[model samples]
Target: MNQKPVNLFNTFQLGNLHLPHRVIMAPMTRSRTAQPGDIPTDLMAKYYAQRASAGLIITEATQISQQGKGYSFTPGIHTPKHIDGWRKVTKAVHQAGGRIFLQLWHVGRMSHESFHANGQPVAPSAIQPDARVWIADGNSAGQMLDCPTPRELAINEIKAIINDFRQGAANAIAAGFDGVEIHGANGYLIDQFLRRTSNKRTDIYGGDIPNRVRFLEEVVETVVAEVGKERTGIRLAPYITQRGMNDPEAIDAILYAARKLDRMGIAYIHLVEADWDDAPVIPESFRRDLRDSFSGAIIVAGNYTAAKGEAIIDADLADLVAYGRWFLANPDLPYRLQHDLELNEMKERATLFGGDAEGYTDYPDCQEKAS
Candidate 1:
C-alpha cells in the first residue's frame, strides 16, 4: 500500500535553525520543580527528553527573577541551582535530538505575597484584578487563592526588570538552551505592561501603543544581544483575555512589533490563539498581514489538531503548529500524526497543574507499542 500523507513531518526553518518536523510542543506549566522557589529537577529533564521528538519544545514559562514568580512550584532561571538544573534538562533533550527554547517570564500583579521573594506583589499599576493564583505548601495540596493589590512600579524599577530579563537570557544560555523565548503573553509582566487595561501609567513604558510595547522591544533587544537574533523566539497570547487584561489593538500592536522583530532578524513568533478550546477565528486579512510583516517562522497554538494544524500551514498562515493539551497525553505525538493514530483521551484536568511523577512522566509513548 502507498504511504499515508502526514504533514506533521514536514520540515521547516526558523531563521537558520532547521526543524525535522512542524510539530512544536507548546509551553506547559508542569509544576514539578524542586521546592522553595521551584528549581528544575531531574524529573523535568526526563519529562522533556520523553517529548523531544517535537520539532521544537518551548519549556514552561520560567521566572527571570524572584519578583517574576506568580505561583509556587514553577521553575525559575535566576539562581545558580536553577541553571544547573536546566543544564541537565537541555543536555537530556539534546541527547534525544530535540531543540528547546527557554521562555523568560514575570507574573507582575498576578501574584500574591506568598509567591514573592520580598513579600509584595509588583505591577505596572497599583490596580488589582479579579484573578486567582495557585499556592503550594509541603504536605498540603495546592490551592487557588485570590490575587492581591499590587504596588505600582517606578520608572527606574521598570528598567531594572528589563535588566533582569537580560540576565535571565544569559542564565538560559549558561543552562545550555538552544534559544530563549520571551513570555509576553498570558497576563504576565510584559503583557501586563503592554495591555492598556492592565497598564495605567504616565511613564515612557505606557501611554500609546508603541509606548506600551517599549518594554517588550527593550527585552527583545536585550535577549538578542545575549543570544543573537537567530536564536530568539517570542510567545504571545494577544487574544486571550485573562486576569482583566485586554489589548484593543492587540493584533495591530503585535503585528507592528512583528515587523520590527523581522527587521531585527528574530527567530520565531509563537501565537496562542485563545485561552479556551473554541478560540475565535483570526481573520484572513490579519493572518496575511502577519505573514507579510514577519519574515521568520510563525507558530500558532491553542487546542489545534493535526488536520487543522496542517490546514493552517497549507494556507501559509503559519509555518508551524504547537500542540498544547494533545502533546500532554501523547508523547510520540508527531509519530501518531504520521500514522493517523487515535489520540489518548485527556480526562484528568486536575492532574495538569501540580503533581509528582504520576499523570506527568507516566504518559505512555507510541514507540512502546511498536516494540
Candidate 2:
C-alpha cells in the first residue's frame, strides 16, 4: 500500500479519468424530473453542474424503457426527448469540469401494478416481495404503494431486456455521458436475478449461481458491445436485504460477478454498503476478498463521514468513497470537505420529489453560506 497520506482530497486515476480528488458524488433519486415523460430538466442540470468538483457524478437511476420503470418522476434514457434532456445536463456538468456516468435501471418485482401494461409488475418469478414502490401523480405528494405479484418473464423477454439495456447505454452515450453504469443493486431487477429469494426459476436463467447470473452477464456483454468495456461500470449491493430480498446466495454470486466483470475489463465496480443505523456490518475480510477479485476501481457508498472515508482509503479498502445525502444538500461538497467548512442542512423534505427548483437547485454552495 502506497501509504503517504491517503485522504479524500488526494488525486486518483480511474482508467482514463484523472480526478482532482477522491470524493465522488453518489447517485441519488430525488424524483425531481419533468413530469408526464419523466425527462431531465434544466434545473436538474444546474443541480448536477453545481457539484462538478467531485471525482465523478453518477446520475440518478434512469429507466431504460417504460416497462423498466417502477417509480414516478424518475428520469428515463429511452426516448429522444429524454436524451435531449440529459444532453443539457451532461453539457452543464462537463462545462463545469466534471465527469459523469448514467445509471441504467429496471425495477423488476419492486414495482407497483399501476406502472405496468398488463396490470402486473415483471420479475424473475411471480412471487411478490414485501415491498412498496414510489408512485406519484401531478396532484398531491407521492406515496408508497404495495408492490403486487409480478409475472415471470419468458426467456425471450429476458433477451429483449438485454437489448433494452444495450439501447439505453447507447442513448446514454448520445446524451454526452462520460460513461454508463448498470444499476444491479438495491433489490432491483439485476439483484432479483442474482439472489435466490426472488428468483425461483426452473429454466436456464435460474437454479445455480451461473444460471442466475446469466441475465447480468448478458446485459453487461451487450452494454460492452454497445459502448465498449472501458466506458461501462456496474453497481452491486451484496448486503442489502430490503423488500424481501434476503438471500445468502447473493454473497457468492456477487463475488463471482465481480471477478467476471474484471475479466471482461469493465471500468469499475461500485459496491453499495448498508446506510441505516441498524444495517449489518460488512466485514473488512470481504472487502479484501472483493479487492482481490476485481482489479478495477471500486467506490463504496453509504452513510460515511470524511474520517470514515479516509480510513477506508488508508486501509486500501476502496479507491473512492461516495456521499449521498451530504452531496445532495451541499452543492460545494468537495469544497466544504476540503476546507473543513460547516455543512448546510437539507431544508425541503416535502419538495424533495416531484417539485420545482425550490428544493432541487436552491441549495446554496459553500461560498454562498460563508458569504
Candidate 3:
C-alpha cells in the first residue's frame, strides 16, 4: 500500500523552529531602506508584517558592514542604529506570528567605487565582475552603475570580515531575529571566493577546491559559533553563470562545502536556482547529490509555482519552497496557494526598487480585496 502524500501546507520542523507550512518568502533586495545610514524603517516593518503568514521569511540581503554594501538603500546590520531599526521589524513580525531570518551579505566585486571611501571594493582577488549595482543619485533616484576593478583583500582583512559575520549574527539575535542566513550565492563576496573565475589568489584561501571553500567555511564556523548551528542557514547558487560567475567547478565546490556544513549540523541549505525564462534546468542528479551530502533541511527557490513546489517536496528533493516575486505581490500568498485564489500582479515595475508603499505595502490580500 502507498503512504500518504506530503502536502506543501503541512507543518515542518526546521531546526529549532516549528513552521506552520512549507511556503517560504525568498529574499529579494527592494533597496527601500532609510537613506544616509542604511537603516530599516517603519515602512519596511509594515511591509514585512503584512506578509506574516509565510512559513518563513528570509529578509532582503542585509549588509553585515558598511564595506559589505553594494546597492543603494539596502539595510545594514552593523551599527547600533541598524540593530534598533531591525528590532522594530522583528517585533512587528513576531506580533503578526511570523518567523524571519536576516540574510547577511557582502557584495565584494559586485560593487561600485561610490560605496567605498577609498574608491575600491574588496574581494578575494582583483578580478572585476561584469555586473552593475544600483547607486542612488543626489535626488534619491537610482541608476545601475558598472562595477570597477576591486582591490584584493589582505590576509588580515579576510579575518576581519569573518569576524564581521560573527558580529552580524550576534546583532541579529539582539534585534530579535529568529535566525540568520549567510548570503553565499549570486556572485557576492562569498561566492567570489568560492569560484575560480573570480578568485586567483595563491594563499590558503585560494587554489584547489578545499582552499577555495576555506573562506566560506571560516565564515560559517564563526557565525555558527556566535548563534549555534541550529539557527544558521546558508544560500548558495551553483547553476548561476551570470555577473561573471561562470565557474565550472562551482558544483563540486558547493557539494564539498555542503558536506562540511552537514558535519557542522547547520539548519538548512537554501539553493538559488536559475530563474530566467530560458535558464538551464537544475538536473535531478545534482538534487539527489545535494540531499545526500546535506542531511538537514533544504530550501529551493527560483520562480516555483505551487504545483512545482509540491512536486519537489513530494519527490523528497527539497523540504521547503521559497517564492520571491509571487510573495512580493501577494501578502497572503500561503492562503491563496492553499485555496487556489488569484494572485495580484505587480502594479508598477519601477516601484519594485527604492520606492515607497506604492508597490511595497500597498498590495492587498484576498480578504482586503473582497471587503
Per-candidate Cα RMSD to the true structure, in Å, reads: 2.0, 2.3, 2.3
**lDDT tens string, model 3, 205-248?**
99999999999999999999999999999999999999999989
Q: Could you tally the backbone clashes for each prediction?
A: 0, 0, 0
Error of 1 at 125 (Å): 1.0
Predicted candidate 1: what Cα RMSD to the true structure? 2.0
Candidate 3 lands at a TM-score of 0.98
**Which candidate's lDDT is highest?**
3
For model 3 the local lDDT of residue 347 reads 77
**lDDT ranking of the models:** 3, 2, 1
Worst 10 residues of 2 by lDDT: 1-10
Distance (Å) between predicted and true CA of 226, model 1?
Answer: 0.8
TM-score of each: 0.95, 0.97, 0.98
Q: Tell how far residue 14 is off in model 1, in angstroms.
A: 1.8
Candidate 3 regions with alpha-carbon error over 4 angstroms: 1-6
